[model samples]
Target chain A: MAGVRIALWDLPTRIVHWSLVVLIPFSWWSAENHDLERHRWSGYAILGLLVFRLIWGFVGSSTSRFASFLRGPRAVLAYARGSGDKRLGHNPMGGWSVVAMLALLVAQVGLGLFASDDDGLETGPLNHLVSYATAETLTELHELLFNVLAALIALHVATVLFYLFVRRDNLIAPMLGGSKQLDAEPAARPTMARPLRALAVAAVAFAIMAWISKGAPLAW
Target chain B: MRTRLIIGSVAAGLASVAMAQVPSVAEQVKARQAGMKSVGAAFKGLRDEMSGTPDAAAVKRHAAVLAGHSSKVGGWFGASAASAPGVTTAALPAIWTRNADFRKAASAFDVEARKTLALANAGDMAGVGGQLRALGGTCKGCHDDFKAKDD
Candidate 1:
């Protein structure tokens, strides 16, 4: 049962992961209580974090990059049939699920930008740019998209549990601690981008988010 | 005697048909929604106007709209309207069961709305802003118990 411990991911990835874990619930609570001010801030925070993650997917670390996990459909099929190569990172199928989750989250935040409540009293920061009819429609879609996001999150958890119990893999611990218990010590240390680089990416993400929160006007 | 009896029966049938043509619960719900939206828009408009050096006429118009809608807020909700089957609404069943409390909230809202309009008419923008906050509280108080959550 004992295994070698190997470094699996960078700290930025772990922070982004856990931030989502907190923000998702906070978003729900704010909306349920009709606290639109808090809800808007929550959406802005999510928007910033998602931007960071998307950028990190390109340039942060090896396992965090899309190139490392993504495979063609044929590879996914082979994985499903239990014949694909086993890697330390996400299996082929999980690669696409991660992409889907990120895509849905992005879409959800986009819709919230233009959404207006039934009475038009509460509105997103960008609601001023759209017609009332369009804002209302986006609001409906915003609610609907949240449900879709919820479903995907449920499936995501189910899969994680399946791996934890049936496959006897502990995926959660590695995510938290950034190290994995492996059968053998990895031969090469996975290279992490400099912390400065991550700070640069985060700065860029949150700056854009802050601008949008101010209604994304040219003058502002 | 036979002719008179026949005429009475026809009259009763016609009255029953007329009753059936009256507004259904769904219609009431729709009107209630429209009225509520109008009131909300008025409140938001007033707040926007009050944010700067307000045009007194604009403030008066917005305040009047709120006053008018708030006065009718009572008729917009009813025993038949709350949680009516096949009706889509944010109204909770508690609106009917807690009738006395709901009425009190509506009355408070109506009082604040009228006071706001009067202040606007007197060119008292200072008073209008604070009054609306009190008005907002009544709205929140009712919504907390009587309305379903937006989520």
Candidate 2:
């Protein structure tokens, strides 16, 4: 059925999503090739992006907010049963998937901060803060978690393909164009994303990243 | 006296024959590998020490060892050494294909290693740590471009 195209994603969210699409692979390549410096910096960028996303989830556009997408278990069950609310933002299952991915990414990046390799050449900036055993443990977790993330990413892509071909929902277009053509009026109408707020949030994220990179000194 | 002269000449010929049995390329590669292994061990030792009590003297010793190894790293990758295949090595063919870039990376690593050594000798653990990070970056840069991935 024909429907009006309404805004579904903000510019900042789209930028973050596409940038991640590029940077994630870049991170893997750098790590695989032993380009630890590039890998480390990519990780830092990911962390910063994640931080901005967390903040934007609250202060960003209507469709981008966590409150707009996250739903109760009942809603997810209903969606599974093919009887769910038609919404503009993420569906129930998709919402939870987003949450899961974000949580995993946070864990991965957090563990990386304390990780060290056997070569003794490359290490996290804050590796000195932890004991050798702790660093080693975190390093192991970091490696293992990447595999988990890779699997999840594969699943995510598969799901997106399913929506595109089977469900006839062009999810990629909405993400790229920041709007989706819907059958009915969007439940959550588009609102100003407040680019200034996003900028402020990004500044804070960068400051935190800079401090962490600088060994997170307690005092000046 | 003639018999004694013949025996001496035979012994000298046997020694030269034994030396020729070992190819020069193989010998060079072996020596280079040994030097790299020593550098790796020294780096590991430094990290282990830093992980514990941060001993300035021990760090200095290991850093000096690294610096010494770094200086010889360039000479180890001779022209013949790249083409000759004898022992198992992670060195990729690109090291020879991009000879100038590889040499630049090696030289950069040497500079960082020397800086790290000086910092360690000064007992400046913080400075040493910073230099170690840079040194590690240089090492990774070369490895990324030149070293083959372990399967």
Candidate 3:
């Protein structure tokens, strides 16, 4: 059957994905090189992206919503046994991977807010909210989570490559172009995501980050 | 007249010896590393004093030491110091390539260090603490750009 081309990812989702692709490496470099200012800003940017994604997951297109793809364990097991190929959005297994990645990212950035390096010169803006000991513990967790994130990113890339070459599915093109051609009937035709709503959500996320950055200095 | 000539000759010899004793690139690197270690120690001492009932005298002493070391930081990063062969140093080639930025970072550190010293002398422990953090940031800024990754 001739495939029908349909909209899959929204502009906001595409932008967030690409921005993360660039910003994650930059964040790693800044941290490794001790460019604490850039590192901190990058963390905030990631936090903002995560916040936007969380909001988008709720009010986005039908395909982008968490309810669409986050299937039960039985569905994931069925996907693992080779039964989940005709869907339009994320496959059941891929959906869980997405959730795992988002959760890990949230943990990483959340710990960073209270983290401090050994010299105490470079620290998270909200570092003052906690005791030095608490900050230090969070710092350790931040470092550890970075390693975990790195490993998970490697795995994610490898999975994408496997889908591209072995499964003959070019996930990246659809993610970039926001549309995919399917050989079978599309699972569901989702309306385009609302860019204005995305803008409003992003504004709210940025404002919260700014307020956190201002910090409670008197608490320190 | 003969005594005067002898004294002049002796002075010229001493001057030649001083010129001949100029440190090698490796020696300069080592000297700078030592200087930075001392600065770190002094900064730590000042930070420790910030805890409770700060010793104003100790604060002044440590801050003065930090300022003294900060002033010498730029001089220590000589052109050849980064390229010195057979030396195990964390100094990266960017220090030479991005000379202007490096110098700016170093000078900013010096300015912050001096400010910190003034604050310490004025018995403003809180101000000193804040300035010290800024001073350390300048150091980190330069190191991030110019120092090779140890890991």
Candidate 4:
């Protein structure tokens, strides 16, 4: 039997994910309640988390790379057929969902940086770049996307539950504990410490995200 | 729209005469001060009537004052938008390029302002708050797209 010996999540990656789970809802609540200061700061934190994840996915570990989980359409289709095939880490569908979620989040957070609440007391950091008409459209899009993300999240949770009950799989446990013991080889293991090279990459990505969230300075 | 523009221009001209040279920042400060004053007086009027029986005349007075001042507020910005470049203001390069969107937002504010006036005239305090909330939304809508954050 394949024992769960590898570490799937590094310290930084785990920290980023849990922080985001808390921050996203907090930011949304602040926005709705017209808590400008808290909303802006929460948004900054989200941007930081996203940036860190993007970097970590690249060079942190073997399983974290896009190449490992991002499969061809044919492979994805085969996996969907209940072929009893499994991935040690992210399966193809889950991988694509991750990409979609990241893209949507980036757009949402980016537009919010420039949003104004009309009361002179609140505005996004980059609101100065666009025309009022453009801002209106962006704001509307951002609001609509929130609903879309919520629906997607529900779907994702339902799928996980389906896997647990019907497929007899425990996907959530792996994510929580960063380990999965399977009776198979070629499975993903977690990383305890990210290499210095990976750390440097993560720092660069964080700087880029911070710069973008701050309205790229020159554009400001 | 044209009439409001004229009134705004006239008021702006008169306001400018009081100073040697009214900087854009100074003009903005003056406009904000006036807005605060008008809102304060209206809120006080609202509070005073809470203890009394429903008064139609008082309602009309409140509606008229709000509509007038709101229009002037719109005009103040409209005039400023028109005359901004003359005063060396780096308001945002996109503001001039995408003037149509700015105008649309301004027009939208005027439309909502009129709607609020109609509701107030009809003595529908029950509905005025909702309408005002929607009106406030449009203001943010425009600002998000066109205006830069306060420097």
Full-model lDDT for every candidate: 0.84, 0.82, 0.81, 0.65
DockQ of 1: 0.20
Lowest lDDT sum, 10 consecutive residues, model 4 chain B, at B43-52
RMSD of 1: 4.6
Ten residues in sequence with the least summed lDDT for candidate 1 chain A? A116-125
Which residue pairs show backbone clashes in model 1? none
Candidate 1 Cα outliers beyond 4 Å, as residue runs: A1-6, A33-40, A86-88, A114-123, A127-137, A181-189, B1-22, B44-64, B78-89, B93-100, B115-132
RMSD of each: 4.6, 7.9, 10.0, 17.5
Q: What tens digits encode model 3's per-residue C-alpha lDDT throughout A46-66?
A: 988888888889988777789
Q: After best superposition, candidate 4 residue A189: deviation in angstroms?
A: 5.2
Clashing pairs in 4: A6-A190, A7-A189, A7-A190, A8-A190, A128-B148, A130-B145, A131-B145, A131-B146, A132-B146, A135-B145
- Model 3: residues with Cα > 4 Å off, grouped in runs: A216-220, B1-130, B133-150
* Candidate 1, residue A132: how far the Cα is off, in Å: 5.1
Native-to-model Cα distance after best TM-score fit, residue A86 in candidate 2, in Å: 1.2
Clashing pairs for model 3 are none
Better of 1 and 4 by DockQ: 1
Ranking of predictions according to TM-score:
1, 2, 3, 4
Question: By DockQ, highest first, what's the ranking?
Answer: 1, 2, 3, 4
Q: How do the residues B19-73 of candidate 3 rate in per-residue lDDT, one tens digit apiece?
A: 6676678788789988876776676567557644588899999899988888888
B73-137 per-residue lDDT for model 2 (tens digits):
77788776776545677778888889899999999989988999988988999887666668877
**DockQ score, prediction 2:** 0.17
Worst 10 residues of 3 chain A by lDDT: A211-220
Preferred candidate (lDDT higher): 2 or 4: 2
Cα lDDT of model 2 by residue, A1-220, tens digit: 7778787798999998998899889988988876889989998999889988988888888877899889999999999998966776789999989988888999998988887665557788787677656776888889889989989889999999999999887899989998778777765577857788888988988888888886687888
